[model samples]
Target chain A: MSFLELRGITRDWDGQGGVRDISLSLQRGDFLSILGPSGCGKSTLLRLIAGLEQPQHGTVVIDGRDVTALPPAQRNLSMVFQSYALFPHLNVAENVMFGLKVRRVAARERDRRLSDALKMTGLDGLERRKPAELSGGQRQRVALARAAVAEKPLCLMDEPLSNLDAKLRHSVRRDIRALARNLGLTVVYVTHDQGEAMSLSDTVALMNKGQVEQVGPPSTLYNQPATIFAAQFIGEPPMALVEGPLLGLREGLTVGLRPELIQLSPPEQAHLTARVLDCEFLGSETLVSLDHPAGQGLAVVLPGHASQVPGDSVGVILPEQDRRIFDTHSGRIEKASQQNPAALNRQNTAPRDGQTAPEATEPSFDLNRTTS
Target chain B: MAGPRAIQGPAMTDPLKLERRRRAIHGWLLLSPALAMLTVFALYPSVATFWTSLWSRGTRRNPSEFIGLENYRALLEDPTFWKVVWNNLLYAGVTIPASIAIALIMALWANSRIPARSFIRTAYFTPTVLPMIAAGNLWLFFYTPSFGILNKIGALFGAPSVNWLGQPDTALWAICIVTIWKEAGFFMVFYLAALQTIPPDLKEAAEIEGASRWTYLRRIVLPLLMPTTLFIFVNAMINSVKLIDHLFILTKGGPSDSSKLILYYIWENAFAYFDRPAAAAMTIFVLIVLGLLAAFQFLVLERRTHYQ
Candidate 1:
């Protein structure tokens, strides 16, 4: 059984606040990253599980108990905040011992645990140093040490690496993720950084407008998005959306293609012709923006060493298997060969009395490439 | 060896340099009024007081005698002076911690998620802006022997009504209570400003670490407020020493001089007894004591500046 569960949790706040319904579960040692843009209520989900904020409805089940009504102290879960929030007055040792002290653990046991936590964070020799005396990276470790000393089965992180510089966030995030795994802890990490979500999570819950758009392994979320929002949100530089009729497909089917998946063909070897509108030379990859006269605009990422310039005519090709088709009206994926062009044209033209499908319409495609 | 030294430069001793020097002189000329007033009002009095401390009890006209350390010796021997010092000590003991505790509690309550926080803050701070004499009068009514609001309420609870400021044993305490009521709200403003600067993420971190609210306060809030606490403590001590306005209205140096502060005693020696030289000597002594206290506080601050 999963060790933690949020069952139909809906929190509705007042005054311009939105409602969020989040139902998820985590098994022991599972690491879940809640990734979203700001104001998407990812932090609210963490707070609900921690009992910092009660959901307007639904229960939080931990192990087997309904702990939704319990206070944060009773939840037996440790959290790391974005600011690290180490106690400025207490030395590193005392900070790690704070939870143990409050629980009235024996002094000897508290000291032993504190030392162990310090050693794990590589802060063993700096036990006597106050928080202000430590660097930003050191403070982050102390906060982790403080949480780790609790030995709680569950942990929560609210953008804990947001304060560190790019270089430090890179290392500290790995350290914290390793700490969670080594301790066999179940962690729910919240962040807007897609990179962090992709790198550290066993499961990633992509959120939008206070709801989970999709939940899956990183590779699955990237390769197979369930919705347009998920497809656009999960990838860097976003997915290029191209709209037009499908050439080899039936009606009510719209095709989607990834930038790198679309190949640039030679003029003589061209499968389809597209106008090269612009090109960008990134260090390792060259991004070429192509426009199809009848199809949607597309971006193609070529090797950076390519000598393609803007306004050049190019040929494009896609193997039949790489094409993705979605329902024209509902934006849901449909089988490519099962659609009817006549019925699709009627559906598209019935709304416009004067316009019939341009009889000689040609299908075009879009390509959007992301380096990572 | 150098081919030709640059031509004798007139820029180093340029006439424009003289013009700029002239402008600097004019700037001081424009500031002379405020400078003269500062010299006359601040420096002259301080120097005069130090000089007068060397003389004995002297009249405004001609009664004068040189008594080098005799006034200092007399000050050491005076039992009443020691009692006044002891009373000040007792006053400080009662008021400093009380006011600081009340201020901190009020700041925290105002800063936290408690409901009606704005209303509570306004009520607490209203007393600070009121005239001290008016506050003293209001407290006097509460401390009345009988029929006062406090005694009336006490009697309703079946407790006996007793003298609050009428007895020497309780007079200093009565004044301390009024002083705390009049001043704690003022100190609370400083603490409120400090509390707002503490990042909310820190407290959330503690909560996530499985710390209770009380533990968070003891381990996080209190330590973060240390610099502000020290600031309020030293300033409160200084204000209590100089705050004789309410003492004049409420106790008037008390039923038996039990509420006499050092400044009030100095006032009596100078104006009431017409002892100019004695007052000057006492003034110098008080300045030394206050100077020493300030220096001690500075040392403490310098040692802990890292946290700030």
Candidate 2:
């Protein structure tokens, strides 16, 4: 059985809905990243699981028992906020001991756990320092240490690394993932950063609007996005969306292709002819923005030294079997296939991802990206 | 523009000459009105008061003759002057702390998420805006011996209707209560401003750490509001010393004159007894005492700042 389960969880207020019937379960040692855009209700879902929020209609089950009506204090779950939410007045040691103190744990055990948590988070030497005296990375570590010392089985972090600089974010992201893994902790981590979710999560629940678009391993979601929203939301530079007639479906459909799968080569019989609109050269990969005047704009990632110019016309080899198609009207996944026939074929591909299709549009993305 | 620039290149470049010209015109513009007001209201009267303090109390037309330090010596000997000074000190000592405590409580309650908080804040602060004389008059309804509501309520409790304002024992207390009622709310506004400046994030963090409201207030909120508290303390102290406007209506230094403050005594000597030299001497003494109070407050506050 899953360690944590949310059943029929519907939270809404004042004619507006938050997470609509969010039913998901987590395994014991699994790190599930809930990826979504800003208002996709990922944080709300986390809050519901943390018992900080009560669902208007649903049950939250933890370790086989219903904890739906439990208050945050009784839930025994630990949460780390994006702001870190460190107690500014308390030094590192006191902050780490807060939960144990509240729970009335033995003083000696409290001290032991606080020291252990601090050592685990690399914050042992800085136990005497207040939150304001520490750098952003150190403050986050203190928050992590505080949560760790709570010694809860379930750990929920809401965009914890969103505040750190790029270099620090990457390094700390790995440390946190490793720490959670080593503890064999059931972690429900929320982030809009696809990179963070991809690198850290055992299973990524791609959400849009207020429902999960797809829940699978990172590679599965990347290779076979259950919905067009998931395909657009969970990748670097995003998947190139092109509006075209489906050859097999014999209808107007929106075509999607991953930038990694699009190859930069001269025109062949099977290739799509497009002109290079722009090119961004990172150290290892070059993102070439290809303009298909007949189709939609596409981005193709090639080798760093591809030597492509803006005006140069190039042929993109979008493998037929690798291409994804969605209904233009519904924005739902019509087909996840390598071969999408030309506009003269079938009308639409059925929505098939082995799980339920997203109810409405569950939106999620990195908050820092939008807020920045 | 070209022609003017060509003519004034070397001329405009001389900053010293330009500065002198600007200062000559601007100096008069800035100082003229202030200098005029000071000469008429402050400077001339101060000189006259200094001269008068060295003389006897006499007619303004004849002017008092020199009696240097005699008025000062008389002030030193007068038992009533010493009593008034003591009363002033006692009034300040009692009122300052009481008003500050009440203000702090009011500010905390007003800042919290209590029911009818807006109404409670307005009701508490309403007395502050009322004219002190009017407030004093309103309190008279309760201070009256027999017909007052306080006595009527006391009678219900099986206590006799006792004279309140007419007695030396209770008159100071009566006056102090009225003063606190009027001043507590005014001080609370300062505290409210201070409380608002303590960041909200700190409170939220404390709450997440499982700190109850009390713990959060004691450890985080109170420490952060120290600077604000100090600021309000100094202002409240100054107000307590200077504010005796309500006394004239409420107590008027009644019965054995136990409620008499220094300012009222100064009023009695200056206007009622027509002793201008004595009044001037008393005024100088009052200024000295106020200066010392300000100095002591600053010294205490400076040390507090260093420790914090």
The number of the candidate with the highest TM-score is 1
The residue-by-residue lDDT of candidate 2 on A139-188, one tens digit each, is 99988887788777888999999999999999899889878977778999
Number of colliding residue pairs in each model? 5, 32
Cα lDDT of model 2 by residue, B1-308, tens digit? 12222334356558765666566557666778998999999889877887889999777588668999999999999999999888878888888889888998989989989999889889989998998778888899888888898999998998898888889988888888887888899889888887886656555445555667787777666766676667777776667666567678877787777898888888888888988899899988877777787788778765554122
Question: Which residue segments of model 1 deviate by more than 4 Å?
Answer: A15-19, A104-116, A246-254, A266-278, A291-297, A328-331, A335-372, B1-43, B60-63, B144-147, B151-167, B301-306
User: How much is A333 displaced in model 1, in angstroms?
Assistant: 3.3
TM-score of 2: 0.80
TM-score of each: 0.85, 0.80
Candidate 1 structure quality by residue, lDDT tens digits, A248-334: 444444556667788887655544556677777888998887765444446788886676666666767654466565555555556
Candidate 1 chain A: minimum summed lDDT over ten consecutive residues — where?
A345-354
Model 2 chain A: lowest-lDDT 10 consecutive positions:
A359-368
For residues B239-270, write the lDDT of model 1, one tens digit per residue.
Answer: 87787887788788977888898889888888
